[model samples]
Target: MARRALLTDRERELIEGGGDTDDELRYQAVSRVRRKIQEELTEDIDILRENHPDLYAELREVVCESN
Candidate 1:
């Protein structure tokens, strides 16, 4: 299933405003959302590692280069 892109309230307003917003603001807002998503994914991975070690091992095998 496709998920909606996460956006801050300010980002939502800027998008709804229809232009005139600064480019730097757009970049910062996008960066904020990207960081939030990364943090959430990392937390979920940690939980999976503790609760489902075998599955986490398989995931690590596919995703980790050094491990």
Candidate 2:
């Protein structure tokens, strides 16, 4: 079993709230939120690889990483 990344309504609120103030603060907050989302996406990919090895291999061959 793998750890799941679950984003709740409260978590969404917190992420959104981080952008309410000054531009610098909002930029930092948005960056943090983006990092968190990327982490979660990676975790999800890991779990898929573990549970569906063949599919994962196929996906890896077909998908390209973005900048």
Candidate 3:
């Protein structure tokens, strides 16, 4: 199954200059939206792992472990 795209209409509008014009304000908005997207992506990855245990196990093996 294809992954669902992130970013809501409001977020897209903000990114496309449909929101604040001030540099600082725009930066804050973009930063907030970016963080939200990252969180959603992490959640989606977790759900995929839950649905496919073998794939998840292989992925864990490939990922380097930290001390």
Candidate 4:
């Protein structure tokens, strides 16, 4: 079965300016995506970091340490 996306295509478009072609479009998309992720996840992340440090660290290490 196909997995569902956490964010919808409309959400992506709203965040990404609808696939605009410009020199700065990639940069804009990256900035917008990063900012949106931080905005949406920061609160829950903070709570998890404080209350469930192990799980938080595991997730953080997986996402951050992979690269």
Candidate 5:
């Protein structure tokens, strides 16, 4: 799998371990990791939109239709 960018130490540890502890803390950590990933993906898509308008428009249409 491709390695993701900008992961914090806590995120790395959480992803690697299966140890069960506080359920609330685990949920929060998972939410934070998901948010970080979404932000990174949004940035990448913005770059693509700027660089390739036609492709971006096509992708936008497909995404919108799915939603």
Candidate 6:
């Protein structure tokens, strides 16, 4: 099977385990989701990332985290 591009549980755990502040953790999570969304959802992530923060976040949370 093709490796799923969506963030995996292990990836999330490792990222969470890292000694980072809340802001840093949130950044990492969003960044990871954005990258995965770009891979599977759209190439023009800049548009969404810049113009639609709420949509961008929802997509990342609903789609990227539920693999």
Model 1's alpha-carbon lDDT is 0.74
TM-score of each: 0.45, 0.37, 0.45, 0.48, 0.45, 0.33
lDDT of 3: 0.67
Whole-model Cα lDDT of every candidate shown, in order: 0.74, 0.65, 0.67, 0.68, 0.74, 0.68
Error of 3 at 41 (Å): 1.6
Task: Give the per-residue lDDT of model 2 (tens digit) for 1-67.
Answer: 6443344454445556654546665566667668776887678679889999887877677666533
**Per-residue alpha-carbon lDDT of model 1 for 1-67, expressed as tens digits?**
6445466568776645556888777777777767876997678679989999997897678778665
lDDT of 5 by residue, 1-67 (tens): 5675556666767766667646666677788878865887688779879999887887678878885
Would you list the clashing residue pairs of candidate 5? Answer: none
Error of 4 at 26 (Å): 8.1
Q: Judging by lDDT, tell me the better candidate of 1 and 3.
A: 1
Rank all candidate structures by their TM-score, best first, as comma-separated numbers. 4, 3, 5, 1, 2, 6
Q: Residue 16 in candidate 2 has what lDDT? A: 64
Better of 1 and 6 by TM-score: 1
Report the error of model 3 at residue 15, Å: 0.7
Model 3 / residue 44 / CA error / Å: 1.7
lDDT (Cα, tens digit) per residue for candidate 6, span 1-67: 5475456765566556655536666677778777777675675455678899987887779767996
The candidate that wins on TM-score is 4
- Candidate 4 lDDT: 0.68
As a TM-score, model 5 comes out at 0.45
Q: Is candidate 3 or 4 superior in lDDT?
A: 4
